[model samples]
Target chain A: MEELSKKELVLKQAKLAINFGVGVIAFASIWVFQFTIFPDFFKPEPTIVEFIPDSTEPESVSYFELDSADIENGIHVPTGLIVDDGCQDVMVTCGACHSLDLVTQNRATRDGWKEIIVWMQETQKLWDLGEKEVVILDYLAKNYAPENTGRRKNIENIEWYNL
Target chain B: MSKKDSRRTFLSKSAIATLAAIVGSKVVFAENFPKELEPVGLQPDEVKVKIPGKSDQLKILNSKPLSAETPPHLLDDEVTPAHLMFVRNNGIPPEEVDVQKWTLTIDGESVVKPMTFGIKELMDNFDHYSYNLTIECGGNGRAEFNPPAKGNQWGLGGVACTKWTGVRLKDVLNKVGIKDDAVYIGYYGADTHLSGDPDKVVISRGVPIKKALEDETLIAWAMNDQAIPVMNGYPLRLVCGGWPASTSGKWLTRISVRDKEHDGPKMEGQSYRVPKFPVPPGTKVPDDQMKIIESMPVKSIITYPKTGAIIPKGGSFEVRGHAWAGDLKVKKMEISIDFGVTWKTCELKDPINRLAWQRWKINVKLPEFGYYEIWARATDEKGVAQPMVLPGWNPKGYLNNASHRIGVRQG
Candidate 1:
């Protein structure tokens, strides 16, 4: 039977510990050197783009309230009347939902508006007009009618831009 | 003990220690970096999950058709092609119809009589006119809101400026004298409501009386120089200048004047409201908890040399942008070359229309060419210019009028 002396055993253990310690030290040294010499290589550079942070807060900009001063200043003067030929009563009743501006701004004939009214009744479930439909149609026909004024000047000059 | 063994052991231990140090240090460094500074690359393939059927059968605004899947950022052009314009239908688009079969009926509580008429009779009966107006989505520029808001994130190009051919609104009002008790006028489009609770009611919206009399407002049948694109209300639509885009209905069908304000899905509950005060971004405002939306704030965007364009340094470069306001004219546009340190007022071209966007062009020497960040800010007639810093945040994204900052290479 081979027997190891205590001193020999101690030496063997010491040698193993030293080898492990040295190997670790060497690996760490390489990492330190890399970080110092090439720090940027580890991290990607951020995009150099500037973006304006949008505010989610809704700002109370302004609304179209009746401005006597604006009208008096001649900025927005009252235009002449718009009456449909056969729908005075209907115009009055429909005006209840919105302003005459809503009605007069449109350039449709009586049939177009009629379809809209039908759609509203059938789809939107608007209250029945009872007898006011005829009067409204007459007024729309009389006042706010379609006019073909050639081509719109502003749109005509919108030159196309290349992408 | 072998000398070689001791040396090797010592080296290994030291290496391990160094590795341990590096790993520990890396964790600390990573935690300190800000999220914004982190490289979050472009998500080219990102998909938006939306509420179902909300976007079905959406029409393109221009002649150029766009796949419904197109991203909003891809629409950065001088004029958003008709197909590229955002489609925001209140209801399903109606199939084309014969004008012969069409009729417009005006009804509801009013002093005048209720009426309905055919297209021929209406056309033969009334006067008509046209005007230029700008229509924008109510949620346009939502992406620009700080703190982030909840809604469709529209880019800057959601708005389109076009000449609307129609008759005067005041003319019709004059025909039907209001009974003074009328409070609101509601409009309905030909579109069908999305799949939801049937009891929820059909889509409708309304505007007030005073605005109806404004001469600039019109009932338009034509957009640009041609018939109104089908996506934009083919038969007839309202054109209210300086109003929120949602107020101008599309696929318009019916108009009813009401004695009192009508309460409905889109009238009192949707579209035309703002946060009473600043809230956190991305918050959904509760219904009956916001202020009514009104005029748009002064805003501008640079169109030329687009952001991130490479330009020759020290050469003469032209910077141009479009500026507009709710009710005022653009008196001045300023350019900052030194990143807000110095500013030079740019030259503005003559305004084509009194109430439309004005083009401003600035020829700058761009002296000492280098990679410079260029920005443009517009000031309105009211002396209100774009704020350098956003005021705050809200649940519903509203006005995002921050000046534009474009990156350009000067060299």
Candidate 2:
């Protein structure tokens, strides 16, 4: 290497100093972003609130009593199901997988209810009901038996164009 | 400058470069790795349950009942893969099936001699056949009902066409020697009811003797050249082509030939029956007036350029889909881009198997950037076309053959 003049040596040193300063600043900025800014920016958002209505009123009685008026007048109960003696058990057990509307909408006899329960337990992996099975069956059969509201009259006397 | 100074500078530069490289690698790694995906709409227990080889894109309708539907867009292939086929289970699928021990029993009034055969013996004795069959749930497209049906809400993905390998039902019935008085053929499966009641049948339904004897009907053991998936019925299942899948029982174990109409479970009342005449949606017809649901109507579905897709404003797009008619062959498929105002006939491809869905494709030209509804309608050999709206629905919401509409935005 050739010996540098004093002025040229000063200019070279100045350029080296400027480059080193830039490198340091860049590295420091990245460190600041990683440690100070990133955590706040990437914080998790709050979870969405589910829409299930809570109407369970604290009661001192051994079990929640059904209001006969609500059942007779066809009034919608707080759970969106007909209130009855075994409603609490049904809600806890059946509501785990499906909405209560699936239970209330269809009318079935005691045997039919038993058939459905058997089907559910065998195939759907519903836990054994133990003593609650009897109470649930009786409740469903008593309140939700099939009614004789006859079906609409069949279309009659139309000559078929094709079978 | 001295050689020593130059060497020292070089050493410092290399050290800095190595440090920078390590920092760069860490930053890149953080940005590129994918985050864990959580299952949507699943309970805690359901999150752990996994269907082996199943696509993650399938929408789970119910985890306990194991009801799922394939997204219509994902069904692009002519023959649906076993893993992608929609799963609709009435009961829990048996955890492990012993194929060796499984036996199929054929008995009832029609048989010359009641017979029982192990799966191996059955496969060995019967002549094997394979066909591409489309099995659609009767409740398919039930979600589209206005009032919403009581059962699982399924989109168009409730149906799938798969290559089913099995023995023909007619051949088996012939081997067993059906009597002249037999009027119906009832089916039973090994899957138990929910209550585990030994006496109760989860869902036992059958077909008229004439329909059961159809050449296309089969007792399938394999789907898509593989052992049938557990959810689809392993060991054996009845492949009742062109009818409600319920008639084709899964995990089939017994076939009962009857002298009169079989009154099996799910056969009575309005379980799978619909009104004889067109009735307004939500109307309940008397049991005597109801007729058992049979052959599905002609229908078409657009599989490509899924609904709500956005395409380039001036690009040419190809519209592709599949069409099928129950029993009858598909004669023509028409596509409409302007909400059924004007229609263009699509080129229909030859079906791989009889009664299988026919694929259709057409080149579409987008004049300008706007929203468009692509409608596909199929007409059967009998000249029956799909209705513009859902044909009159009964309480059960069956046989919805409205023209499939896929909305797309051109931008």
TM-score of chain B of each: 0.75, 0.87
Displacement of residue A96 (Cα, Å) in model 2 is 7.0
Instruction: Predict model 2's lDDT versus the native.
Output: 0.71
Residue pairs in clash, model 2 = A118-B194, A118-B195, A119-B194, A119-B195, A120-B194, A121-B194, A122-B194, A122-B195, A123-B194
Please give the range of 10 consecutive residues that has the lowest summed lDDT in model 2 chain B.
B33-42
lDDT accuracy of residue A57 in candidate 2: 38
Q: Is the docking of candidate 1 incorrect, acceptable, medium or high quality?
A: incorrect
Model 2 lDDT per residue over B1-411, tens place: 132343234334332223223223211112111111111111224334466557878877655556788988788899999889988777545555788888788889888888887888878998999999888888887666654345676768888899998888888889888899999989988765433333457688888989898777988999999999888889799988778878888998899998988788778777788888878755657889898888877887888866766767577788898898877789999999887889999999868888688999999986777767788889999899988776777767677787887777677
Q: lDDT of each structure? A: 0.54, 0.71
lDDT by residue (A1-163, candidate 2, tens digit) is 3456777898989999999999999999997888786665566774423222235732211133344553544533533456556665564456544545456555656876886788656554565676667778877888777654322212223222210
lDDT of 1 by residue, A42-143 (tens): 798844332222366222111112234424432223311232233223322332222233343344457756755775565444446644466566555556
Query: Across the candidates, what are chain A's individual TM-scores?
Result: 0.38, 0.48
- Supply DockQ values for each candidate: 0.01, 0.01
Model 1 chain A, poorest ten-residue lDDT window? A150-159
Q: Candidate 2 - CAPRI tier?
A: incorrect
